[model samples]
Target: MRHRVGPRHARRPAPTLLRGIYLPRSMDAGAHAMTTFGIPLLVLATTNSAVLTGVAFALEWVPRLAAFALAGAMVDRYGASPVFRTASVLRALTVVAAALALPYSDGVGATVTVMLLAASTGVLSEFSYIAAETAGGAASRAAGSRAHRVQSVLLGIDQVGTLAGPALAGLLLERYGATGMLTVIAGFSLLAGLLAPRQRDGRAAGLPEPVMKGLRTGWSTMRSLPTLCWLVVGLTLSNLAVGLLQAAAPVIVIQHMGRSSADVGMIWSVAAVATLVAVALWRRAIDRYGLWPVGAVAAAIAATTCLAVTLTHTYTTYLVLIAVLMAAEGGMTVMLRTLRSHLIPASAFGSTLALSALILLAPFPVAGVLIAVTPPALLVHVMTGCAVLQAVGLAVTFARLRAAPGLRTALA
Candidate 1:
């Protein structure tokens, strides 16, 4: 049997430990931001085709849903360290290749190549994301009672990436072409790989099942939790609304609002600031006020933001509303994470969280395709209807969660 380390054993200082954890995560976030913003910008710049831009967007996300369950289950058996390190290295190498090769391709070939890159990047990034979250748990265990504080700091760091990453990418893209921007992104991803820590106790000896069996077990665990399932469904609906904004917002800002891609990056950068402020405000209140109530309020803000977008065409108005929506999104995200932790079993986190993410995120690329095909006027109406559906679904779910007797005790 394994034994615990004694008091005499030397433990790393919290700052040193946190540095090891945050450095990779911070760099990874930068890489993620660059990929998210750069791909669409590169596609549009190359093709000047909205349909192709949407295709690139779809390429990036659709594979994530396909990969998440497998990634999660793989992490369960093999540990996150190797998976993270290998994936980051692959991302670095792939992007480097893309930078060198992409300019040589013809129009049809370029579209196909970029989409393939997006798909591969999507798969690798999903593994990294699951690894980071798992690493956070390890970091928290090391921090002991300060786990919540550690998580808050991590959340803040993520916000910083979102706040600055796009702006940084936009600056680079504006000054340097796609190849230069990709080179920089590859560097960040490489840094993340190099900085990744290998926990001495990272492997899960408990999960020795075959790959397919492990996958099935995870699905069973996730489906058994009705509350969590409902929560995912509600969040999935919210993600569809999010997809509408994400896929449409860039098009709207550039085509409808007559701005540069840099402007769209700036808009997201501003939303990140708003999200940071919201996180600061909501963190304390969530611990005090509980999930359903705070979640309901956040839902209202989200719906209001969607409605405001429908009513405005001004660049400034769209920016402010996106900021508001992102703020609400940040708060709701924290609440949902906390709530999911409460509802999900400890053993099920890896697989179940992956399943949940698959559902919640699947809408992203679908939104892109929808935006691509839908006419502009009709798309606006589709978004408006999405907002209504989001509000109603969240309201009902929160009501159900509030009414459940078992959940009442834990709600606080």
Candidate 2:
């Protein structure tokens, strides 16, 4: 009886801890996705301007990038649970406030209000995300040899949220309106806040340092890892094409293709399924072929699909190409996560992760600006140029990665 009881008690913490993190993270991720997709669509719906939609997209990503370092520092000082819950609650309240104020706002005032909401929520979402990531990192570190398995589960949960949020947001926006959509998003945020688990010690390692200091540590860490640097460069280039397409999606579907918001959401929802399948395959493929070979294939597929997507005029072709492109993106993402878990030392993991995220996210605002300035008809040409660059860049990067000694030793 004592032996059985002791063994059962020892096994209980892992599943319970995972649930405490995974459940709230799922809710938080879904709310974040809804806000991301919904806000740009909202801007388009309200202003009937592609430029404003682009601006809204920039507003969302820029602040999110800016907040990463600070959020990492805060999570280190205050612990993950408190920071996550606070950010979640703040996001919910902010969304609710925006929903209430939108109806009372005048023409320009309404636009300004929405823009403010986008920026604020973007910052808050980053805070919650970083905290959640920190918690997950702690759990992974605890798992020791099974860290990759834990990360795979977390990635799958993120994909599930991505699957549900955009389609639901589009439907609600089409049927009900911005207010209804915002309310639902707020509910999810509130749930995330309520579901946060208490940290065991309620604090992290050291006293909080400046964001710049964190960046310096992260930057130094990146320099030590040449493979990670090259991969970042390739991913950054790929993201430019991906980001541009995402920013221009509403305009392309609704204005150019004469489709509805639901169609816009459907594109992403379907693509997410392909991504999920790709992620699953990536897990198995990595074991048989190793990282470099699998990653090279993914990069090739992504590049080819992006190039093909530029020539697509029909909605069906566009959707299919985007799905394939996203599938490739998903595979590459798994490779990156696996590499990150293995390469980045546990001591600097949070700051380095935040830094890497910031670098990757740098392309989104640039894509937003391109969308704002470029003619909608010529956006395809821009995509073609970006796709060509991505292909070349990824090809070169992977060639180096295949030859890199550091990566070879790490894999060994």
Q: Which candidate number maximizes TM-score? A: 2
Scored by lDDT, model 2 comes in at: 0.85
Stretches off by above 4 angstroms in model 1 are 1-17, 138-148, 200-212, 404-412
Tens digit per residue, CA lDDT, model 1, 251-338: 8888888998889889889999998888877766655665566666887898778777778879998899989998887777776665
Give the alpha carbon lDDT tens digit for every residue of 1-412 in model 2: 4456465545555436556879999999899889888888888888899999999999989999999998877776677788899999999999999999998986998899889988999999999988887778777767765555566677777777777888998999999988999999999999999999755434446668799988888899989988898999899999999999999899999999999998998998888888877787876776566778778899999999999999989999999999999989887887777677767876777688889889988999899889999986788889899989989989998998998653332232
Alpha-carbon TM-score of each model against the true structure: 0.89, 0.92
Worst 10 residues of 2 by lDDT: 403-412
